[model samples]
Target: MKVLIITGGNIDDDFASSFLKKNHYDEIIAVDGGLAFADRSDLSITYLVGDFDTIDRTILEKYIHRPDICVHQFIPEKDYTDTDIAVKLALSLIKNHHSEENEEKVIHILGGTGSRLDHVLANLQMLKNILDEDVRGIIIDRNNIIEMIRGERVLKREEMTGTYVSLIPVTMELTGITLSGFKYPLENASSHFGESLMVSNELLEEEGRIFIKEGMAWMIISKD
Candidate 1:
C-alpha cells in the first residue's frame, strides 16, 4: 500500500498539487494544520490526526462530521509529536491492510521540512522507526527527497529525484561503504559524523548502487 501523510510544515502548493496529480495514493492522511492543504486542494483523505490547535475550527468540524474519514484527536500536551503519532498509525493501517497480493508498502511524508529546524530533525530521526518496521518512509519537499537505509540500495538515473545524491551517516560511524555508478565513487570506505566527504555525488551511469556493511545512513537526493 502507498500512503501519503501531509503534516504541518512548509509546503509549496505548486509542487505538492502537481505531485498529487501524477501519483496514485492508496490512502492520504492530514495531520493538524495539514488539513488546510487538503482543504485547499480539495483532496480526499482517509484519516485525520492531530490536536485541534493549528487548524481552523470550522474546517476541523467539517472533517470531523465526515462519516467516511476516521478522526484521531489528541491533546496539545501529548508527549509525542503529531507526526510521530501519524507515522505509527500509518504503519498499523498498512499492516492490517497488507495481503499477499499487495505490492511493497511505502509512506511518503510531505510538509515535513521547513523553517523549524528542530521539527525537521525530529522527523528525520523518525525515518529510522519506519525503516525498522520494514516500511519505506520518504520525507520530501520541493527541493529534496530523503530516506534512511541500511544494507544496499540501487538508484536508477531515469528515476533520479534530483541533481545530486548525498549520503550522511545516521550513526556515529558507517563502515564498509561502497558506491558505484556515481560521479565520485567509493569502495569499502568508512564515514563518520560531521564528515562531508560523501556529499554532492552525481550518477555517472544509468544505475547507481550504494552498499553499507554496517550502520544506517540518510540518502538525500536534492536539487539547487
Candidate 2:
C-alpha cells in the first residue's frame, strides 16, 4: 500500500496536490497544520494526527465533528513530535491492513522540511530506526528528497530532474560504494562525515546505482 504523510512544514500546495492526483495513494495522513494545506489542495485527508497547538481551534472543531475523518489529538506537552506520531500511526495501519508478504509498502512524507531545523534533522534520523524494517519511506520537500538505504540499491536518475545526488555517511564508514552513470563515479570508496567525496554529483546518463558493502548511508537527491 502507498501511504502519503503530510507534515506541518512549508508545503508547495500546487506541486503536492498535482503529485497526489497523478499517483494512486491508498491513504493520506495529515500532521498538525498540514490538514489546512490538504484542505486548501482539495485533497481528502483520511487521518489527522497531531497536537492542536498550531492549528486554528475553529477550523479543527468543524473537522473533528465530521465522521469521515479520524482525528487523533495529542497533549501539547507530549514527548513525540506530530510527525513522529503520524509516521508511527501509518506504520500501524500498514501492518494491520497489509499482508506480511507484501513488498510495496511505500511511505511518502511531504512537508517534512523548511521550518524547525531540529525537527527536520530528527525526522532525517528517524529513517535510521526504520531502515531495517520492511517499509520503504522518503521525506520529500520542494528542493530535495531524502531516504535511507541499507545493503545495496540502484538509483536511476531522471533528466532535468534531481540534478544532483549526494550520499552522506551516516555510520559504519560506508565501504564498497560504487556510482555508475554519474559525473563522479566511485568504486569501493570509504568515506566519513566530513568527507567531500559524495556531494554535488550529477547524473551522466539516465540511470545510476549506489552500493554499500558494510554500512548504511543517507541518500539526498536534489534539484537546484
Candidate 3:
C-alpha cells in the first residue's frame, strides 16, 4: 500500500498540509503527536500508533471511539520509538496488502525532523531500515527531501523539487561513485565518513544520475 507515516516531531502546518494534499496515499498512520497535526491539518488518519504520551487525553478518547481509525497503544518505556513501531507495522501491512495502483510499496514520512537532533538522526537512519523492506522511505521537510539510495539510480532534473542535491555515504566507504548531469560531477570517487566530500551539488541539465558499485548513500535534495 502507499502509506504515509506521520511522526510526533517538528511539523510545519503549511508544509504538511500542502504535501499531504499533493500525495496519493492509501493510508496515513499518525504516530503520537502526529494525531494533533493530522487533526489540525484536517487529514484523516487510517491508523493511530503510539503510547499516547504526547497526545491530549480528550483527543485520544475521541479517536478511540471512532471505528474507522485503528488504534495501537504502546507502553511509554519501550525501546523502539513510536515512529519505528509505526514503520514496522506499515511494512507488514505493505507486504501483506496490495495497493490500488500496482506499484512498489512506499512510505513518506512527515513531521519527522526538527528541534530534536537525535530524533532527526534516528529517523534518517530509519530510512535504510524502511528501504530494506523493499519499501521506499523519504523524509520530507520544508527545506529538503531525504532518501536512502542503493545501487544505481537516475534522478531526472525535471523530477527534482530542490535547488541543491547532495550525496552522503551511508556505509563506511561508498566506492565507485559516479555522477552525471551535475555542475560538479564525479567519476569513480569514493566517499567515507569524516568528510562530506559530496554535498551542495546542482544539476547541470535535464537529469542527474548516480552509479554506486558498492554500499549506499543518503541523498539529500534541498530547496534553499
TM-score of each: 0.97, 0.93, 0.95
The digit string of per-residue lDDT tens for model 2 on 1-224 reads 88899888878877776667767777899888887787777777788899978877776776776799898998989999999898888888887784656458878999888879998988898777556666787888778878988676666654334678888888858788888878999988888766778988988877787778877778888887
Error of 1 at 38 (Å): 0.6
Candidate that would win on TM-score: 1
lDDT of candidate model 2 versus the reference:
0.81
User: What is residue 45's positional error in candidate 3, in angstroms?
Assistant: 0.9
Sort by TM-score, best first: what order? 1, 3, 2
Q: Against the true structure, whose lDDT is highest? A: 1
lDDT of 1 by residue, 1-224 (tens): 88999999999999999878877988899999999999999999999999979989888888987999999999899999999999999999888984566488899999999888999999999999999988899998999999999999999998886999999999999999999999999999999888898899999999999999999999999998
Task: Candidate 1: count the clashes.
Answer: 0
The deviation in Å at residue 156 for candidate 3 is: 1.9
Over 4 Å off, model 2? 100-102
Please list all clashing residue pairs in model 3, or write none if there are none: none
